[model samples]
Target: MIYNIYFDEANKIDQPGKANSYYGAYGGSEQTMTDITQTIQRMYEELGTKSELHFREYNHDQHLKKYFKVLHYIINQDVNINILIVNNTEAHSIAEQLNLTMMELRNLFYIKIPERLFYGVTRHLHGQLDVNIQIDRNDEYDALGLHSKIKEQMNAHSVYRSKRYKIASVVSEESHESIPLQIIDTFMGIVVFLMEQSYMADSNTTLIKSDLVYRFLSEGGNVERFIKQIKLYSWNGNENLSELSVGNYISQFMVYKARYDVSEIAKLQAIMLKNPGLLAKEYRNLMEYPNTLTRMLLGYKDEVEGRGRNYLLFQ
Candidate 1:
């Protein structure tokens, strides 16, 4: 079988002190690509939107339904997603400890992060599949240069050392021209957002963000069941990368309910009465407020409807 991997990055690429950086690669067979594109086209038609589906551009409550549908389509399809998360502050500390230059650190990140993510995906192939990787075009690295670096790393890895597994090509392409790249871009957005929320010390923000992600996935199918099909790999300036299960993350978040201030609870009640969708909008608004109560209320509603936990404590 021929497998194509589409790659993209989220957040500042070379900046050292930033909180988070993510590189994601998602792809499947050619047939799966066709199926995904067709489904996305149908969604656009239904929504009367002719514009391309870019996660950053369309992240809002009004577009939440379509976003959920797109996610559902990707999850139900044969595509695989792998994300490499970098804690830049930690990475910088490690670089300084190792006496590495900023350029050396950046190059290491660009090369190793994607290489590890790709290795994780390719290692499972067992030399049975031919792979072609296409990365989204970026000014930071030339196409030929990146292709060479990736090819060299793949060759060094034990997983691709077999004669039977052939890397057909590794090239960069304009994201606007490829549906799979766009799809991966959208997925990366969610991945980055969820990772950021995972680090938040505020229990309410963490719980709300987790529930929002759960609801988004639940729209397509059973979130628990669907999570088994996806893989998440996290790196935080450690010698080894760790794997996280979406199901377990959701379960952990669901069990914890932080006490909300009485005034905040009242605000949430008023917001729910006026427009429940507004809560979703607020969740998407990364700029202004934490809006932890909105997520708590949503989780409570889900519990009441028997879609999630059986009981949630407001206090």
Candidate 2:
């Protein structure tokens, strides 16, 4: 069967920081992709929109229902997404200590990240898995000449190595032309944002973006399923790449509770929608806000429904 792979990257591609760079390839079988693309195309056509669908272009006022349906459709489909996180902050120091140039280290990642992503998806299946790849082009990979290396590396792995995934072709395409690319592009943006911005010490996210994020989390059970499809591959400089250390392991993406804290997110939005006036004009100790608000919301819930839903806290 033919597998369609749409590749996209998010975060600071070559920058140094926590959750800095992410390389992702997301898609499913050709038939699956075609049906999804046509469905999304009809959504846009129904709204008289002649533009690309992207998380970056997400607007709470304009595109809420559109994006909601998009996410809903994606969750109900069979898809796989793998993201490799390069903690350049750790990698830079690791490279420096090992006396290796960043270029050399980056070259290995270019070859291995996508290789690992392919391994992740194809490991379970068997027989002739012909893969077609379309990448959302970026300058960082462009400098590395990844255009050719991507196909070369994947085919080389499948041809000689026991890797079962084979690449038929790799091409660069605009998200506007392909709905699957746009879908990958959207979720790729979300994964990177949740990892990078929430981890930033002093970052204050825009309310509109957070609104979209809350809506993204509004998927409920689908959120967990969506999270499962995205796995993060990491090689923080803690491991010696030259030594090829056995201690190294690539894991899936994880986020702290502040943003992905779905319970608090739901409560906050519910409160904001129900009665914005009950909120304080200013708080002296902002650190005390969550607990204080939780108490208030619980009290309000009890008053309205005649019982406290303390059980939801465990979930």
Best by lDDT: 1
RMSD of each: 6.9, 7.9
Which regions of candidate 1 deviate over 4 angstroms? 13-17, 126-128, 155-163, 198-214, 252-315
Residue 209 alpha-carbon offset, candidate 2, angstroms: 2.3
Q: Looking at model 2, which ten-residue stretch has the lowest summed lDDT?
A: 243-252
The residue-by-residue lDDT of candidate 2 on 1-315, one tens digit each, is: 888888776655345444467777786898999898888888778766776767766533345456766777786789887777777777677778889887787776676677666656556656788888887766656777776787886787677767676788777786777788788878777776665554334322333345455445544566666656666666565352221211111111123333444465465556555654453322202223433243333433443444533222222
- Top candidate on TM-score is 1
Q: Model 2 Cα displacement at 201 (Å)?
A: 9.5
Candidate 2 lDDT at 95 equals 73
Error of 2 at 46 (Å): 1.3
TM-score of each: 0.72, 0.69
lDDT of 1 by residue, 1-315 (tens): 787888888876355445877888886886778778887888879887766557666423334446556776677776678877777777778888999986777777777777888887777665566778898987666723778888777766644365455667888899878878988887776565554545245554444444445556544354644566567877777889888776665444433322232344455456556665554546324223444344445445454346653133111
Worst 10 residues of 1 by lDDT: 253-262
